[model samples]
Target: MNAPYSRDCGPPPWAGSGGAPSPRPRRVPWLSTLLVAVLVLAGSGFAAKGQPDRERLDAYALALLLLGTALLLARNRWPVASLVGTVATALVYLGAGYPYGPVCTPTAVAAFTVVVAGGLRAALWIGGGFLAGHALIGHWLYQYLPPTGDPGVPWGREVVFAAWVAAVLTASELVRVRREAWARERLERAAAAKRRADQERLRIARELHDVLAHSISVINVQAGVGLALLDSDPEQARTALTTIKAASKEALGEVRQVLDSLRTPGDAPRSPAPGLDRLPELVEQAAGAGLNVTVETVGVRRPLPPGTDLAAFRIVQEGLTNVVRHSGSRVARVRIGYEAGRVVLRVDDDGPATGSDAGGSGNGLAGMRERAAALGGTIDASHRDDGGFRVRADLPAPVKETV
Candidate 1:
């Protein structure tokens, strides 16, 4: 149950006149309260029968039991108040010469509620004081306070009462600790789910950016060529239009694959992911866009991890796309290196700077970096001393163990 509000019914002091109404309070826990009341009253009546020397049961005794039950019903919303109320009623019942039975049950339940509601220190002080005061009344003051000529109780009974109080407090602390653990576990699960969603969003953005950027760059160059050659060189214009068609088709296919994966995640992909194995297609596409590309290999030839291959392909693709859009030179070179448990890729262009052209260099570069970083790799891109641009990436590519 939630915490209690003020006794009077009104909006809180902090709420504005036009603000939302206060949250509805939970109803008092009636069923459990009724059960405890029945048990306490019946058990005391039975004990009173055996303890004939004690003052007989009266209307005041029954009222005390009912009041204790009422206090317990409010325990969830007002634990401290419940603890104080129940403890006071129990003390009064015992001091009035009523025979003890399960009358302390309500106070014990309220004390447990207090500890679990983060009022441990308060429950300890009040509960401890109640036990001490009752012991004083029963052991020393009973001669003057109640049933006349009654003898003072033995010291052993006081020890037993102290033990009962200790047990209740101990049980409350254990339950409090368990509730806190469950609350922490729920929070951790929510945070983990949020993190997973964020990472998936980032991955989707990178995939869409890479697919659209490279393909659009090619289509842009081919369209310009087709427009220039349309009248004088009809055949060349036809070839340019053909390249545009091909580039657009490829972009659409890759985008469809991404969407299909999202629509039915964890299923086998209908098409293979693009990697260094598709380098020849990349080279031909660049040629269609009027930029010549060369591919070179060094060191041992071996298969790369799937993540490493994908990152390397995207890095080279972004690098050449940058060259076509920004560099004055039309020629680019790609170099692939296989070394000790790692693969390296480098793309270069020889150029005089062209400041007028604007492509998505920012998103392209950042996407490449993110892709490399996701696979525990790194990318570096900068201008060459020979007035050219170059992009280099180093990615881990440990060979899979053979069976």
Candidate 2:
């Protein structure tokens, strides 16, 4: 099954300073930074005109405004420094008795950037200190500061500014949460795609294993017989070669079918999948490998779903092929049982284990198990107690959905 995708290997866009490192170096947001600079410069000129009682905007004031906005370029890489720099510039500009309007915009922007970079605590501390300093200078130090005979700023205005600060922090936190959620969703989608790709790959591998393993086993035995009997029994040699040709042809067709499905997954196969209906062919293939297979059907036969039918066919095929390749016995038994709500297949061969066979748990048995497990079924292959090896599959065969 596919899991959610996640990557701790690379950093996100907002990462830096107190946050994660960026996957790639972030480019400066030049246009937006310059726009903020222009707005601050224009707004400060207008504020100076309106507040005739305050110190007029001058070269020093222009330097402060530009410096505050300039710090924004480094906000992503050094958010904590940017926030502190901008906030301090705003305080110096205000401390010099220039009119209050728009001086805090750059500071607010920098603070928001800090929060986005996961420096929430740091932003809070800097913002809190700025507010405290402003309160002290506005209500207490006004007489000694710039414009003469001026009373300090009112408590009501400070309260409003505090509210605005809270709103900026709240908005920044919300944006951070939303960005993280979007990242999580993307990771999940990628993980799901990878999982599906893996399953399809495994399915193709199983199909090829079942198809080639059985056919090659038959071809191997027949080639041996043909080579040995070429001079002594020409007729038998020709017949063995013919069986090899048929087996190879069948293997090629199945392999091509599997590949065709891969090339055009939405198209129907050129041939239907082999089911129990092809049991006779499997038995015949076993015969060409010089083994006799006796098939017995027990209970009432019923139509099966496509998945179960194919699993049943492959399980039986692999079981017989195993007997041909591994068992010393010349005969194998196939029993198909149609019970309540399920179909059972059992293959057995009388054998003292072959020297090269380690209880036959190679790719073929594993493929058989995979097919059965895919359909919520179970497979058991083991050396039988009564001097034989047996492979059994019990698979669910539910009736049609509408029924």
Candidate 3:
């Protein structure tokens, strides 16, 4: 027989095997590459115009510019390596006295990429290296070389170049931090949604177990009685079969009500869930299954929270079902007591336990305890000293306010 509510609460559908989250796809660097290429081409053209040999562009200079642009293509995977290669190419191109404008373009883009990949600390180190290298090579060494008729190192231009590099590095770091923050927010939302779905599934499973277990246990007992009496007494067998049919029909309706609630939201009216008001019908069903049951109440009856009422009803129903199925007992008693701040329930049976249906893993008892605990209540179920089983539950009641 299939268990009513056995289901694996595995990961959400989007999750990978064993509930591990899939790795995020790597972002493409095409946008950055295109921007860098445009800057490199434009800077190279402007620098060539200022060249004394503008009519004849040096092949070596053109080759170095192409090399720097190619290095940027691998920036996403090998950021530090690409940064180093581009910076080195720019230094060599400047030392060759080809042009200065294009060299700064690659250096700036490479520094920005490093900042994006390695964050603020890396930007600081690379930016510092670029500043020191420019001071030593471009400013100091270029002043002594007189072949190109270079005027000299200008302090104003040097200061402006340092500021531009610093601005690019700072902007890259800010953008990287913002992107990381957005990714973290997305992950948090996904985790929260998964948690909600798991909780909902658990609630549905509990409801199904309580509803199906009680109804099916009674039906099984009635059907067994009908089969045995069909040989000896046709009249009693007909009564047992009728009881089985009624129990099965009611069980199907209740199951459909639960499923409908899951399928539709809003205020579509349906049959109300079983509560204390349905306890009489439950007792009649048990009596028809060959168990003599009695119910008694003490103190004034009061309305309860809908959840608490349903839980209390289920606990009682499960207790009676266990007595009929496992205790081999003919007589069962139930008592309800309303007190100052709580409601109490007790179910007891007179029995010599058959042990055929006893010694179960006690999933039914566990379900009862879970229900009680959910409403800030407690339940105790055990074999009585008088050779029977007893289940007692204490449920908290809301305090009344004086006007």
TM-score of each: 0.87, 0.88, 0.79
Expressed as tens digits, the lDDT of each residue in 5-24 for candidate 3 is 10110011211111111122
Q: Please give, for residues 1-403, the per-residue lDDT of candidate 1 as tens digits.
A: 0112210101122111111111233456666677777777776787677676677889998999899877877887888998899989888887887775677778777887778777889998997888677777867788777777767666766776677777777777887798689879999999998998888888778888888888888999999999999999999999999999999998899898767768655798889888899999889888888999999999987888777888888888888888878888999999999988899899999986687565564788999889989888899988989899889999999977889
Count of clashing residue pairs in every prediction: 0, 1, 0
Backbone clashes in model 2, listed as residue pairs:
5-187
Among the numbered candidates, top TM-score falls to: 2
lDDT of each: 0.79, 0.80, 0.71
Alpha carbon lDDT of residue 168, candidate 2? 75
Q: Which order, best to worst by TM-score?
A: 2, 1, 3
Q: List where candidate 3 sits over 4 angstroms from the true fold.
A: 1-35, 46-57, 94-120, 145-163, 264-269, 339-342, 358-362, 399-403
lDDT of 2 by residue, 1-403 (tens): 0111011101112112222222244656676677777777776676566577778888898999899889888877788998899888878877788765676777777777778777889989998998888887778887888978767766876776687777778778887788789989999999999999999999898888888889998998899899999999999999999999999999999999888768755788889888999889999988999999999999988888989999899899888888888889999999999998899999999996676742333788888888888899999999988879999999999856663
Candidate 1: C-alpha lDDT: 0.79
Off by over 4 Å in 1: 1-31, 356-361, 401-403
lDDT of 3: 0.71
Task: Give, for candidate 2, the lowest lDDT window spanning 10 residues.
Answer: 1-10
Ranking by lDDT: 2, 1, 3
